[model samples]
Target: MGLLMFYEYLSRIEALIEKHDDIGLHNYLDAMHAADIAEVLENLESDEQRQVFGLLTDEKATEVLEELNSDDFSELIKALTYEKKVTLLDLMSQDDIVDKLNELPESRQKEIIAFLDYEDAADVKDLLLYEEDTAGGIMTKDYVSIQKDYSIYYAIETLRAIAPDAETIYYIYVVDDAERLVGVISLRELIIASPNRSVESVMNENVITVNINDDQEEVARIVSKYDLLAVPVVDNGNVMHGIITIDDVLDVIEEEATEDIYKFAGTSDEEVYEHDDTLFDRVKNSVRSRLPWLVITIFGGLLSAKVLASYQTTISANASLAMFMPLLAGMGGNVGTQSSTITVRNIATHMIEGADILRTLIHEISVGMLVGMFCAIIVGTAALFMHAEYHIAIIVGISMCANMVTAATIGTIVPLIFKRIGVDPAVASAPFITTTIDLTGLTIYFTLATMMIANL
Candidate 1:
């Protein structure tokens, strides 16, 4: 349905729930997709969310809970009764089950674990052992696999038996006698091929797999780079453990994007709209993320102050120099930030490798020089019009050109340096780049001002 129609439908559902005060309203809400239901719940107040969620069937509740963001998921979990929580946990997939458990307190997790079925409990425990941002944590153990010795007919029959629980049936894995992943076959191939054909004969042996300990970001990169639907996970023994589906990789991509944005804005990785967090808790999370950058900016400001102080006598003699200082610094900062952002993004996407780093830096420096020369002409002409001394205009022009070159070089280099040191370039780039530009711009401006004005 169109968005307008969906909104109208939700409005009608809200009115119906208010008017009827019955189970029919609950049934009407349950019939919608989980994503749609999540949207509806998000629009409601906290108390209203609790009330609506309480009325949902356990299955519907599980679907909606998974669809919600982490903050909303925590709130929903808190709102649910102990029995309802157990029911929701039982209904969710193993990966989701572990996610919810990790979000809860240790005592709550222990209590929930006691109620889980042995198989599910074991899977959850195994998943919890891996880092939250690793391949093992994101992969689902539920997938259709068969021995390579099995004929197409046998594989199809086996798949049909377990299709209900599998996350996807697009790719069927073929395992050797040792239960090692040997090959992969698509559902389309299975349906087209003769029934008697052995899986080993038909399957593609050049299977792409990842180690269970691989970083989730690396997993997402591989999936996106190869345009893969799913990637197999293997242990040290090369035994197939689980598969990471495209949907899970998409979640990783989103999480990475959110993290990058937060780092860019000098915020923490925690949810910004946490419902139960106290004001102090919120402040603590935000402050910790922001303070380091603020500290760095302070040092940058200090450097600018020192540079200006060194040229105080010259600036006092020639007032025009002070007017252009702000303009020069601002432009340099803008150019630096732009270069840093581009380089960081390229590195993150794996488009730029370590080997290409020097070449990229040199290219950026050359581009900066060209841009600086153009900006210098404009600023110099403006300075000439504003000031009587031709030497002062030339000083301003030379400083502008030098500042731009410095800005671009520092901007491009900072991110590369961070990446080499195993730091996320995005997180380290912005504040440092701006700070470097500010300091360098001021130094250039003041030195030029001192040279021209002192001579005059």
Candidate 2:
């Protein structure tokens, strides 16, 4: 919805709430989509949010519950009566229910599970065993699978019986008598084939699968690469456990993207999830995440200062050399940050590693040199116009070009090194990159200035 239009609806909801118009509020909510309702709930006060949520029909309530952020979901569910919670959980998807239950205390998880049906409870418990970042954690048990010996007619009949409850019925898996995944057949293929054909004959055996222990990101990569609607999760023995749908992959992508964004900004995504917390806790989280980077930057600042002090004699010989120091440092930091962003993005997309790493580094540095040379010409001319001295112009231009080259080299290499060391490449963030570049840029500038002192 448009911002202004949403605010209008919000205003009307607020007005309705004040007047205690339950019927009107329920009618208004029915007209809005679940996602939109979730947004409205976010803007409302806690008590008001509860009141508004209470008005939603069971189906709408379950949909809205899935749409809410984790914090909101937990808080709202905790506020509801036990019976109400069970009703909503019953309507929600199995994966979504597990996600909500995972956010609650263990006692609460057990309490909710006890209220759920036997199979649903068992599925939730089984899914909870995997690490949250793994493929099994996100996979849903709600998928269609049939015995390999089953005929196409049996498969079609089974799909009809289970299709409504299954998260995805497009790709039907075929398993052996031991329940080991053997092959897969698409819905279209099954429909057109002869009714008497066995699943083993029609199903493709070259099934692309992900290990249950595989990282969620790898699962997303496979799903994207193969253009799969869903991928089967299996144990070492190839016994299929569950299926990861595209919707789950989408959630993982969004989460990883958000986490990377926070990391690049020299912080953790914890702060975002804690946005509703008290002011002090927020500040503490901010310092905890950012202080390490700031410490590194402070150390870099000291080293740069030491470099400047060592070149005091050269600096005093020509104050104009010091004048262009900011230009050199600024250009270097800018180029380095640009290079870092590109490398990090490529790494996130699984494009740069091994031989690709060296190629990316060389390409970025070469591009940086060409860019520096172009900027050097402009700056050198500007220096001549500003200082009207060949020595000053020559020193500044050379330093600028050299600084840019070093910046790109450091920027590209540092992230790759971090990745190799099993650290998140995004932790080689802009602040760290720019700080290191500035320190090196100063050394390059001052060294050139020292060399030019005789002429000055």
Leading candidate by lDDT = 2
Compared with the true structure, all predictions reach lDDT values of: 0.83, 0.89
How far is each candidate from the true structure, as Cα RMSD in Å? Answer: 2.9, 1.8
- By TM-score, the best candidate is 2
- Backbone clashes in candidate 1 total 0
lDDT score for residue 313 of model 2:
88
lDDT, candidate 2, at 245: 90
Error of 1 at 307 (Å): 1.5
Candidate 1 regions with alpha-carbon error over 4 angstroms: 1-14, 42-51, 54-59, 69-90, 453-456
**Looking at model 1, which ten-residue stretch has the lowest summed lDDT?**
267-276
Residue 362 Cα positional deviation in candidate 1, in Å, after optimal superposition: 1.9
The CA lDDT at 456 in model 1 is: 72
Residues 1-456, model 2: lDDT tens digits: 889978988999999999999999999999999988988888888999999999999999999999887668877987999889888887788888777777778887786788677888899899988888999899889889999999999889988998888988889999988889999999999999999999899999999999999999899899999999899999999999999998889999899888888888888886764446899888888888889889988998998889889988888867888778788888898999889889989988889967898899889989999999999999999999896579779888888888899999998889898988999998888889988998889888888777776655
